[model samples]
Target: MSTSATEPEAADLVCQLDNVQGMVDALTSVRWKRHQDAVVELSEHGIVLIVEESRCLQAKVYLQRELFVRYGYSAQGRPRFGVSLGLFVDCLNTFSVPGHSSTIEIQYPGPDMQLLLKSLDSANACIYAEIRTRIPDMVSWDYNFEPAGSTPLSFTVKSSALKEAIDDLEWPGSSIQITLQPVPPSVTFRGDGHGNLQIDFKYYVNTDLLVAFHCDHQVSYRYKYKFLHATTSNIPASVIKDNRGSKLTIGRGGMLKVQHLVSVARPSISHSHVDSAGYQQPSRIAYIEFFVKPEEDEATGNDS
Candidate 1:
């Protein structure tokens, strides 16, 4: 087949990242349900991977353009495609090697495009895999969470503290209640089941636990513990070590939003470059966010 000069090539649309495992880990951190497929949207800014569960919750893993050493897209408009999340994660996992650093390159040609992944490690080891792609579904969950506009009761808590509190609680509960007020016990968690358990969050004199707390009116809402526990249960160890906190917001009618800032790429000397002063520049800081929605229930009508 003959190709024209103005035509786009199969390798024209490509994105290369220095740390493939970092991106993989971020996506897998929020992988609670095994959906058959996921949607990948490509644009000038970056790439976004969307995963949903039973139409109740949605998680997005974003890899911004700055995270990539090289990112290119020749399409006139944004391009989106769907691929098997399981297969995709498996392909990335094939390149996993202990004590080795790897880079990944992804290429998308055109219609009937196949997703290609190439990984190269410091040990000169190379791994490549190609998976098929399909047109994404027309229906997708919209995650337009605007806390500024909405009158939501929001607060921030250290991820480690929250994880520990949830772990210590007795499980097998049907629902979990979150109560926020403008007084002491600013935040409260109640698990209703065979045994009642309550974990309260208040300003301590010697500790910096709650970073921020804001509430207009005292509100209490119940959510499926299973759904709310997904994020806390599967928290990445690195997130806990880094002490990255999570911002939780509860809107009217029991809508819950959990947001986390995950460090995707760590600053390293190898990734740095020499500056004019002959000193190595610091590596770039890259991060991705995880958004989780909990299945909300009717108000419990309890103020205290």
Candidate 2:
């Protein structure tokens, strides 16, 4: 089996995850298609799964070491390989029971260099799967987002509300325009097609809905509706249930960056540690990021 030049051939990696469904949900967020391939990079910090589409859209899911119950890494360097994303997600789904939470043990680079996963909850009916892996192709996009000028064009909104607005704007428009201005401190989503539709979130009027708004100058950019929807289409239920907020930022050259946090802690259980004063820490969360390129056209009307 071929491996990255920085990594040794015979290294070993094993980890135990208490929240099987959490892993499933996190991975599913990036599974855009039924048979997409993802690049898996394992480091001392944790595992990173990357999936991209047509070089225009890319997403990453960071499974940090702290999220795992036990993370064992003895590799000389970071190891990266390619695996079938659909197969991996399907295999992990088998370990997730509706009402019963189970633990799963994950190991990498089996004798034949296959990803290994097994359910640890049931001894009699243990579920085990071995998926084939291959040498990963070079990732197409690694954009360094330019700063959004001095004001930092950004906003934070409830994930559920953001998802709803994006879904409702899925009409006949091929591109969606996003505008942010500091005058009234608001963000607008506009879809122009046979039937024009617009949704606005005024910071002062709906403080709770539009939690944070920062825009020094008026900036607007158009993006493919499909790409915009992908960022919120597969948002995990856990994110909505926790009432988490999604952050959106527009960098230089109209690059759009969307960030979401998915908790990996077991459900109905506390994964925090208390200090002497009985102050509890926050649950371990997985970080997800998406980068979407803007359309070729310049900003439309009302762009300062």
Candidate 3:
């Protein structure tokens, strides 16, 4: 297909963000695998970074267009390319200094199609880095989490509390078994090797911690500690500052989805945009989600 005249050429795509470090910090949170490359997708709306580990776990960091001071994409459709995440992150941190903030401008000039990063500091110091890009693999996995349908268990908890609870657990085991029931001891975290921890959210006792819970049938499943630990480790510091929590959904197939809301920008309360359908548009909120696949075993435990 011929390129449209209105479409952004590969070289004309550029994105500029006010807080470079914030972006860097968010990406670093999900840097679990050491040598994995990330696929970068650019569009008029914003940019998305996808990092996958062994096809067992996938983490996505989304930066909305409103978060950027200036964003442009001239491609007919979304443009996707691959680059070493570690290398890209290192380049971003090269200009980092204590108590200093830098504006970041990323450009993709045509021809060579190298990813160019230009960092400008308040003191007028400019640092430029050009990294090569590669054709992203077409066969990328997608996370299709259906919270509306037949999920056996779903709940929301404070990010800090979850982090602390996970950290407090013993790591002697390779897998951690999670048990959720309707009665007391609503949630239980059991280490396969040594420790047994139970967190109860009795209605008369502590209801605040358990934001929402819906589980008609009690369920128990086992997931790798290393994969689950990565979720807590990669939570952006900003998410903690905003006092955000995470939502977890466990499907019948032993698939777990963790969602964390990351505040991007403050909304203008006075004015709100209305779509063509006359629905009021809400404020922009970006979320980072992790999809984890559970190990298959005949001893999936009793949901009874």
lDDT of each: 0.67, 0.83, 0.71
Candidate 1: stretches off by over 4 Å: 1-12, 109-111, 121-124, 148-152, 169-172, 205-207, 266-297, 301-304
Top candidate when judged by lDDT against the true structure = 2
lDDT of 2 by residue, 184-221 (tens): 88899999997899999999998878878888899889
| Candidate with the greatest TM-score versus the true structure | 2
Collision count for each candidate, in order: 0, 0, 5
Comparing candidate 2 with candidate 3, which one achieves the higher lDDT?
2
- Clash number for candidate 1: 0
| TM-scores vs. true structure, each candidate | 0.81, 0.90, 0.81
TM-score of 2: 0.90
What residue pairs are clashing in model 3? 7-74, 8-74, 8-75, 11-110, 29-234
Worst 10 contiguous positions by lDDT, candidate 1: 276-285
> Model 1 lDDT vs. the true structure?
0.67
Task: Locate the minimum summed-lDDT window of 10 residues in model 3.
Answer: 274-283
